[model samples]
Target chain A: MAVDGRDEMRPEDARIAALYRHATGEMPPERLDSAIRKHARAPKDAVKPQKHTLWRPAWRLPFVAAALAVVCASVVTLLVERDGGRLTVPPETPPPDGGETPPFSVQREPPPFSQSMTDRATVEPRSGRAEDAPTLTRKRAEPPREAEVRKSIPESKARIGERSAAPPDGRVLGAEPSHSSDAPASRGNKTSGGNAPLAYSQPPAPATSTSPDRVTAPPAPRAEDDSLSKALPAPSAEASPAAKPAPAANPRPAPQPESAPAPEAKPAPEAKALARKRLESTPSEPRVPARVSALIAELENEPPARWVERMLALRREDRRQDAEALLAEFKRRFPGERLPASLQQNDE
Target chain B: MLAYGEGDVAAFDELYRRHKGPLYRFLLRQCRDGAIAEELFQDIWTNVIRARRNYAVAARFTTYLYHLAHNRLIDHYRRRAPAALVSYDDEEASTSIEEIAGSAHERPEAAYEARQKAARLLELLQALPTAQREAFVLQHEAGMSIEDIAVVTGVTRETAKSRLRYAMAKLREGMQGWL
Candidate 1:
């Protein structure tokens, strides 16, 4: 311990060391020692804390939680059913596949994404030139693009304006030159005159399963449609004789797909106004998309700054066209206001 | 320590009883504050109790205990004075003339009577830079040999020896009359 001779305190250093020890030598307070004594004694018996082994098994708890959540959800759901619908879970909006399946058919097949989505293979026209129908069927497979839908809108509006705008007696596009008989069948649907929202027109089933067999009380006309319709008067039923039959036969138990072609079942702007009219006229909700009334109404009177914010939000919702429409509307609404450079870049 | 680890409560009490005085003095001198010293004193023992299960028979018990005390002292200084930890291992700090004069003015001129030499020695001890004072206290109060001091303080033996030498020289100068 003294190899470096630091241990050899000179007799003077020795005296100084002794002096320091003499003056300052004092033990810690008795209470502190007792506290330490208590701490020391406890750990001997506290060996039970080796619950470290519990963690090895604890890792499985995530799966346990998932299983418990699943079991609890299912048990609770069953109990709700058993209790005659008292303790029911929050209602999830059912996917509006083309036709409504009975409630018991949940998982009766892999969700109707199976029926309407992939196997829309069956919609090749039942009556038109067979070859032309496949192209429309293939086009419907992908959801309609914004540009194409926008492109279809001008044509639809022009056709509606051209055909319907003139007649003093309120006779709009009734007899198409191709389906002259088609006009009356469409006008007959009571709801045809109701300007339904674009969302009301659901997807198409294949021609066969565009199941007229399951037409639920023909969709009710939305209030917005009522407001919108007042802008354009209902075509006098006396004017088109075809507009007469659909409303008269509510459960027109004719299961074979009616006068509206299956291609109208695709939500293309292909036969926009007529199809919307026909969808309203049809007993089942046909995939007839109406005017963009909802967006204009929603974006109405919001703060000008918030317009771009809503546009950005629409873009985030993956409705890029809605975002663009809102942007154009914003530019029209606040013609002089400069949008954020980034939003303008995204718009470009 | 092995006996203590084996749950011999008597062994720990006997160990604490033997070392508590020097360790308390070591902490008191390292920190000039009494409450901080007491707090550090309790902390070192608490650590000792906590580490008892893993207490090995490698180093001398005083060395181990003082090693804990030394670390506790450095931690206390580190928390209080951010630069203290790095400055701690250096050679003795240079005391400024103003600081020396200020502390000197604080000394009781009348109390420098012969019997009060020990009190003056303590005041002088506190006036020394922390590293030199710690080395001197480790040598004197703990009675640690230079090698054991080096091990406890985590310095080389020569460094420890030089610090002790410096400390002894200063105390000798301050206590020249007593000598």
Candidate 2:
């Protein structure tokens, strides 16, 4: 494997040795300088050296090239194979010896929300889930008063009308046996009007595992209310004959089947008034939750929480005007709530 | 060379002044043609200038310089087109021979004798293989060591030694009483 060039070398055997010694003997130190200068200054286009000076240290180049190639290949192979032919997951720390490794990190799946986001709106009903609802106000009292609001609302209205048409209690406040004439309108509300928006909002509530109280939060209540008001007539309109029961308790329930259409007559104006009236009437603390304020602060510092994404999705679906109207109303109602940067940027 | 390697242009000029004559003489002896010798000489010096920036203390300055020269000559022959070596006509041959014979610039008798001897030596040298001639010239005329010669000739020291041996034996046989 190794070539030993000097082993059997003999000075006399090589006349070259003698010639070289003789030739060099005649050369003075000054001559070497002159020759080197003349050679170095020679124009490149001129003929090459009569014979090249460099012996090449012939293996040096190949050895260096091979070493470089090995280093590069090893680096590439390490990148490819170390992760079993998948993309490399760079080591979290660089080697202690201080050589370069890639500066990259692999993305991991998002953390499960229920486990991590404990304070989220997971407790509310599917229809008016608080998380699905954008926060339009920031009252310190909303969280504590949620149950009270649910209790105060007409239970019949709260029944999320689709799943079970049967009354929670057999008491239908007022139902005339001959009242079958107007049943179609009530069914229509459930099928096509306010209840339609209600049903649509409900899907996100369950999917997002958020509460309806989130939607009803007074801060951005108008958009939430608008969506709700749009969804309301659907269920109300869809309520079938089965949903219409005979009078059990009082006459008010009887009128609801009739007055439900009243909501349809001027829903747009009424929903806005209802939201304004609710904001004015409710106690300051109960109107907006402290948690919501904290979330607002967090969003102001960072980006908006999840509902902003839904809003964006809506915007992307050619609902830009709707989204803009809702966003402006939300910002107005929740004066201090921070909008996400993208929304803020768009607004500016 | 050391001074030149350190960037002294004066040193470079001095080295040029010092080595040019000897190198020219060596080239003249090896090539037997003034034009070829001058050309090879120029090449050797030009190479020295090009390599000065990278120079280290390698062997003696003399060895390095001529080592470059020795290899340049070899490369020149290798690179020359085959047809370029066409036989010279009588006039050109005689003129070249006379020039070579006149190269000894000593006293008349000594010059004549040295010319005859050099002529005879050149004839003997031409009879030897290229490798042998190169080895002999580098060793005896250039005064390079077997090791340095190996470096210049791109051969093993053993090979250089073999060529020198073969060359010497032939010269001894061909010019028995000449030296």
Candidate 3:
């Protein structure tokens, strides 16, 4: 046994070490050594790590290639399936229902002129004719006509006459001739803008007969004439060659004086009854034009200056007619509001 | 080790012969049970043979062999009953060096004092703590330095030195009269 620095150890340390050395002389039995030797010589195959066939390089590449091909095929199939299921429609054709109005038809009721004035200052000019066409179509699709306006004047007149005859509160029932007269003009506007060339080819005679009381009402008829005169001129400049002659022939001076006074001789009491019917039937909820409603919703949180900037941008885009109409609608919705100088200049 | 690792059975046989006595004796003394020692002795050798391919000469072959034997002995102690450990401390249950010496000597009167001294030394070793006893045994039987004892027992060299020092001090105190 190797003792560390044994010769230098204290005498007692040497004697104790010697005693342990003598005691350790007791050997392990020879059988234990034989058993160990037997184990050491025995085959060790059972303990050797086995070689796995699947992880061999020769087999790995083919398996990886097949898996990649399957993934690629699945991705291709998914893309093809997604692309195959959509429907395409052309832009120029009207919807299948022949009477269905094209969304851009200018014949729809103009938004209140005041509302459009506000809109003209703030709203961005619509991008181009293609973009403006769809927006205008959707905007004009619904006109803000009262339920009373939708009914025949005689029916509305009779209903109002009954209410007035009752006079529950003794308030004088005076129907403003403006309400009754505005309805037929709205209808005439719808026909003219929606069916354009077809509507223009027909005489203004039918429009006069449809609401004779409106035709006879003096100021209301002039307002209708003024609106048509203002509206017709801008469209005539841009109208197609085929559509150009139609507006000119349709709005000519010949028809105005003849159709203008047809509603003038109608009884004041009947007109009063119609106006009363309109007041009672008109819903209390304020009706905003669909296009303006969307703009207000979008900009309800925006400042007025931002509204003017957007409208000026719209004017610059060559969408002057739409920008003007939007400004007029904006003015009607927010009355007494002053726009920024730049927007006011553009509006003029 | 390198020769054995390269499939030289004779090299392994030479290593086994050289270490088998000290390694088995170390197990026997640590466990104090013949059958358990024999089992652990075989297991340690079997492990060395199985690990031949990975063996490198990082230390002396004796240190490597005894390190394996030291680990096997620990496993044997853990698996055996705790009662068996208590028996290692029981002087009457343990075989004394005097009893082993007495069997070899024919004249009892001539060897009586030597036998008694051997028996006393054995008792002192048995009374030492298991770690001290292991350090002493690894030192005396395997001729391991404090460094090899620490490697075998997985302790620091200072701890192995301390254990061996304590063991020798106790043994010397017990055998002071004989010295």
Considering every candidate listed, which one attains the maximal lDDT?
A: 1
**TM-score of predicted structure 3, chain A:** 0.19
* Best of the two (1, 3) by lDDT: 1
- The per-model lDDT (C-alpha) reads 0.51, 0.43, 0.49
- Please write out the lDDT profile of model 2 over residues B62-122, one tens digit for every residue: 7788778777776766677886552312122222323333433332445565456555666
What DockQ does each candidate score versus the true complex, computed on alpha carbons? Answer: 0.40, 0.14, 0.30
Candidate numbers, best TM-score first, in rank order: 1, 3, 2
Model 2, span A1-348: residue lDDT tens: 001244465443344333333333333245544455555555543444533434354657888899999999898777534322111111122222242211101001111111111111111111222323332122222353333333323332333232124432232322322122121123322212122222233333331332331111011122243343243342123223323543221111121221222222112333223332332332321333433333332332111123465456656877666566546534432233355566778778
Error of 3 at A73 (Å): 28
Against the true structure, what is model 1's DockQ? 0.40
Clashes of each: 5, 97, 39
Total clashing pairs in model 2: 97
RMSD from true fold, candidate 1: 17.7
lDDT of 2: 0.43
Instruction: Estimate, for each residue in B1-179, the C-alpha lDDT of model 3 and write its tens digit.
Output: 78878867788889877777777778877777778778787787778888888988899988888888877777777777777653322123243444433443433344566666666667667766678778888887777888988898888877777777767766666665565
Model 3, A15-84: lDDT tens digits are 6667666666655577766676666666565434334443465688899999999999898777544322
Backbone clash total for model 3 is: 39
> What is the per-residue lDDT of model 1 for residues B1-179, given as tens digits with 9 covering 90 to 100?
88998889899989988888888888888887778888998899989988888888778999999999988887787788565443564443565334544554566666545436567678778867777788888877777888898898888888887887766666666666565
- Poorly placed runs, candidate 3 (over 4 Å): A1-8, A45-348, B82-111
**A205 in model 3: Cα distance from truth in Å?**
62
lDDT of 1 at A68: 94
